[model samples]
Target chain A: MTTTTIPTLPAGRTIKLGLSRIRYEVKTYFRQGDAVFFSFLFPLVMLTIFSVAFSEQSFGSEAAPLSAAAFYLPGMLAAGLLLSGLQNLSIDIAGEKGDGTLKRFAGTPLPVLSYFIGKIGQVFATGILQAAMLLFVAGVVFQVELPSEPAKWATFAWVFLLGVSTSAILGIALSGLPRTGKSATAVIIPIALVLQFISGVYLGFSLLPEWLQNVASVFPLKWMAQGMRAVFLPEDFASLEQGGTWDLPGVLVVTAIWLVVGLAATRMTFRWIRKDS
Target chain B: MTTTEPVVSVRNLHKRYGSFTALDGVSFDIHRGETFALLGPNGAGKSTTIEILEGYRDRTSGEASVLGVDPGTGGLAWKARLGIVLQSTGESGNVTVREQLTHFAGFYPNPRDVDEVIAAVGLQDKQKTLIRKLSGGQRRRVDVALGIIGRPELLFLDEPTTGFDPEARRQFWQLIDSLKQDGTTILLTTHYLDEAAQLGDRAGVIAGGRLIDIGAIDEIGGAEARVPIVRWKQDGERKSVRTSEPGLVVAKIVAQLGEPEALEIIRPSLEDIYLQLVADHAAAEAADLMENAS
Candidate 1:
């Protein structure tokens, strides 16, 4: 250990550092077998179950025949996004906090904000990839039709981006609530399962009780599923919606609100170190 | 040494959590190219003080400057000058040792070569192993590797060798010694008194959120505290005397006893003084509590 002169590091090195963090996050996520399974395989399993049980069944009246696979395809995609962006992401972040990973990062020169940006980037990328896989399976095996026109695809892009961003941010924020790794699943999964049932992912929004619809509407998952339905479902299917219309603009407004709220909550609740109390 | 500005300095630092005080009016300085050790038991505020210096926690009051900048508002450049090895780190265990080190090296503008650091920590053979597959002691080597990768001007080691075996601990000491030789200012906290005596130029003992004593390692408890006890057998009875000058006492005993039987000169080890200091502090604290209760 000879005396090595340390060069003064340049200020504002967060960009490069954050990029490195993102690279590590992506690499680590792919390498972990459980993470790979949950993000990619678990969603596929859920899609298979729903499609097998309700493929030929049609909902609503004889005027419009909406097959169960088609109706549930959009909902399944929304569920996939939620599973990756919210459930998996939150548990991972909370697990890091529980095990002292966040605390260790706090001691480094790397900015805490950069660490979060890296995590969010990983979540967003995984969510997109999982959504694409689910879409492929639904379109090919289940024979569900995707959006044809450019406008509907555009809707899918914004809704997917906004929904994933909102959930990722919410995951980062809710990570602070879990005290340990053992409790992270308990803390995040119950909320995810409840939202899946009430937010029209496992069941049709119109079939759910009116009061339940109103309650679920306040969450991002409901808006995400509604937006996806608008992008995939036909024009007449809007009659079965809560407002008896697609309400694409309302979906955008609701999701945008969630994006803002999630970011704010993350800023307020993110903890670099887990307190024992 | 007095003419040079301290690389790390603290003045009346305080940290409080509601009604509880973690650090109370603690002050110290580590000169450039010096290895300063902080010795204390659990909850003695050693970690709280170290965290404040590392910019991981904020102080309730008083001033602290590391590398001439306040840690509370230190920017990234300021942080780049520090190498910190926490007591217990939670690392993502999926990555290999080399991959983890390579990723961390990018955070600094100029960092030591990753392979060189891995070799310095004696982990060259295990660089390709996943962190989770490594033993507890081997993982600690990774922690140390990350700490020194940036060639930091000052390294903060909080119990850097807690789980290490005897050989590993000695190797770690040599690594620290080499870093010190290269003129990197070091501030470390350890519960092991021998570790402090072996590596520290100076040591401070903290108890009950206060720095009770600070001085050169050999003189931490003061001249009186370092007094040696001379024990000898006289007329089939044991006799002992404590004195600052052991040689003089021994000669006098020999002159009186015509070569004393079973002669022994026992000096107070750092551990002995440390325990005495903590015990004294606990007694004082209990008395204060009793007085307040009455």
Candidate 2:
């Protein structure tokens, strides 16, 4: 006979199950040699290439090794998180759904919210670590100095949080569209390149055509990267670029707007599974 | 009170995806403590109805009550009372079976002891093994472990023994019998009719999004269900007869045949009755469609 006893807990609440799921998600995330390749190795390789290749593009007196690298560091960091939150997240989620993992979960008492919290939590924690690693390497290897002002550092933290949250929701939204891993990659890789090219990750907006710059400005990538540069790079150096003044309010607003839009898209596009497809 | 209410009551339930009517007016009630097997072919609205009753989908019209609560708006307390064992898969296989059971234990207010439940399902030795490493049967036991962890008042078993070998299937039936003895109401859906006869207290046959028959396992097809067909060849003359009292018919036939050439009486199994019922249902539906056209 099955014997059961009630556990002690508050009467009504969705047990966040947050910490438990995060622990499991991270454990599984690291176990896959493939995930480690995209989340960690990809960003490190990109950072090295940009810092080395553009070592001679001078910003003030020195070659752009430090300044250009520092300016684009946020984009590369966003790129690492985008790999975790957008590129890798969408494909893996779609694969799990196709593999019947999500259907298995539907049988449990675990809340629907747990999957999102656990996955995004893993990405967010990794995002923070990726950010820290970038800062450590930039400071130690390239000898780049962050702005001495306390306000800029605080601004950097908040903007990073908002940017990652927005990206994570977009990840879940995209997962609903593809049914297979091959299709997921086809959708993700091109979007990644297009956003990186236009948002000043590879080349500055000044070098891109006016029409392209105008298009890139509409994306959250541009604002997130520019906000990070405002915090780390010297103000006099940053002033050389147009609309380049440290727009703290603009960074917050753009990311916040994306966050809302991402959530709405999630509700509309999300499917537990496409029964017909 | 003579069976005051059914454990599950679904009335005039309808569901649509855009213009397609996935389920059109499906209705049935499962009585308390009865293992009512729902049998249907694929795309016959079997899954759609079950999903709605499980509170995973919403109905476009009509009402559904599982354990006296509308599943459409049912909350955690109500959900806690139902055990659902889905199709077995290795998706949650990264964790050991014991670890997996313990993790699910945290969700329900009252949950069966993880170690004890593991042993009940004959998985004690394999408790430390990752779910992925276990055999298909053992992984199915894990699915069972998670389902019954909460000691649910009602259990929904969806094709629980689909991949099981004969030995494993019998063992699973034993586990189910123990659960039934403890007064857990069960609603099962399967394509296997022998399984239904062996385990179900009652069975229901559904076709074309509607339930055509529901009753005790032996009486599912009414009086005609128990009747047997006697056949024989005497002096090169083939003969056959269908009668309700098979014993009397057999006795009379035996006297006439005098142990003559291959006299035999064949009784209908649940599988036979079930197939006949569904076939008759389809024929009736065709006739109705024809009549309406005229």
Candidate 3:
């Protein structure tokens, strides 16, 4: 007869499982050409086009001026973060749900937390790499100066982490909206595009109308872009920002709030299986 | 491998979706190392019962102990001892067969060898191929490989061979036979009576959210259902009669006809009993509905 006994797993096995999940996620992300294009290459191409088209322009006044390429670099970073954490992650999860992949995992011994950890880890790592590649290309090819000081790098780190976390969490929450893999793109792409435009990734925040700026400020993507600018741009260049200065505290608070809200919403709404499935 | 302690014991299990009752006080037990087949038609609450036992769904009110632990509160330790192959899982499409099996193995305390599992599922040649690229039958084998990879003591297979060719189905049966030989208790739900007859030592017929009948495969519908039918030619007219003792009936017919030609004795197959049970349950449900309407 088959004996029934609960066997205690060795210590640190959950960690091992999480690490292996991360490895699998990373491998799958790289293997899919469309995912790589959107997360990494697409942003670089956008940067190249923007730099070549508007290199001669200046964003702020003469005293603390910034090249268009330098000003656009931080926006590119924000764009990459949104692509990895929001667009790609949501579609991937929606596809998984539609195909019953998440349900399969839910039935297994693997903890649900481990699956989220793996997904978040994959997006975080890829988001960072995409940011690094964008920064490298902007510095080398476009002659854009990145954040050099330790404090600036620290600000960049927290902002990037919070931005990615908020986006990934919201992505997971929104993944529950699409009933099938085919509908995921239809649901997510328009939202992502609108968010990208309003958050000043495609156009400078200063160029947008005051009413548009007010609407954009309610979202984490705008705060993420502002925080990136605070790191990469000169202090006096804050003249170009709303209220005539970079509100560093406001950026932190908004991103943190979104992170908490997104986490809670995802915990409530995320579905492992599609309804019709 | 027989034991008095049933590996799975369920009693008064009830599952409801608002006013709709999926399972109404349905109950059964599966002994250790025994193959128990739950035969049911579509929408018969088979999946709900199985999912509840797998700890994937909440029951309205019931007592279900899988492997000595209440499945409602079964923890990860309890889950590790169970393997569940869902109806249709196409989620691991991006990963190769071998990669998927290797990853799932990490979740278990004592996983089978990855290569051995692949070979056992007859997917050794396709192990390196991505799941999406493999044929439907091959992908089902991958599901089975992952299901058995954990070396689960009690395996739950939900309509496992829904879309397999005859040859593939036979091959899959052989794979299940090997797992049975290893003393893994199996609880499976399938519409195929042949599959139930071939794999199940004991079988249950479920219809209209109730387990109406359950017993050994050969005697599922009771002694009356097991009665054999005797047929013979008499004066160029064909006649048949069902009797508990076919020998006596055949002897009587032979004596009356001088010699019985084209004589045949046919016992009720499992399929016959199953169909009768389902039909009876449907008729009872319709009658109940009519009485309530009045």
lDDT of 2 by residue, A169-269 (tens): 87887787675755876777788779878876767656788788778877777777777767766666566444757666777887788788888988777
Model 2: residues with Cα > 4 Å off, grouped in runs: A1-15, A51-60, A63-72, A92-109, A136-152, A173-182, A234-236, A264-277, B1-3, B15-26, B87-96, B121-141, B230-265, B289-294
Q: How many steric clashes does model 3 contain?
A: 0
DockQ (0 to 1) for model 3: 0.47
Model 1 agreement with the true structure over B199-279: per-residue lDDT tens digits: 999998898899999999988887887788899898899989998888998888778768889999999999998898889
Model 2 chain A: lowest-lDDT 10 consecutive positions: A1-10
TM-score of each: 0.90, 0.84, 0.91
- Which digits, one per residue and each the tens of the lDDT, describe model 1 over residues A67-98? 66777878888887788888878899988887
Over B165-222, each residue of candidate 2 has an lDDT whose tens digit, in order, gives 8887888889899999988899888888999999998877778877778788989988
lDDT of 3 by residue, B1-294 (tens): 236888999999999988899999998999999999998899999998898898878888979989899887787888888899998876648889898899999999899999889888888789888888988878888888889999999999999998888988998899899999999999999989999999999998888788999999988998888888899887799989988889988788778877788999998888888998899899999999999999
lDDT of 3 by residue, A44-144 (tens): 88888988888788876787677778878888888888889988888889988877888888767887777888888899889888888888888987787
Q: Ranking by TM-score, best first?
A: 3, 1, 2
Alpha carbon deviation, residue B256, candidate 2 (Å): 6.8
TM value for model 3: 0.91
DockQ-sorted candidate list, best first: 3, 1, 2
- Model 2 chain B worst lDDT window (10 residues): B86-95
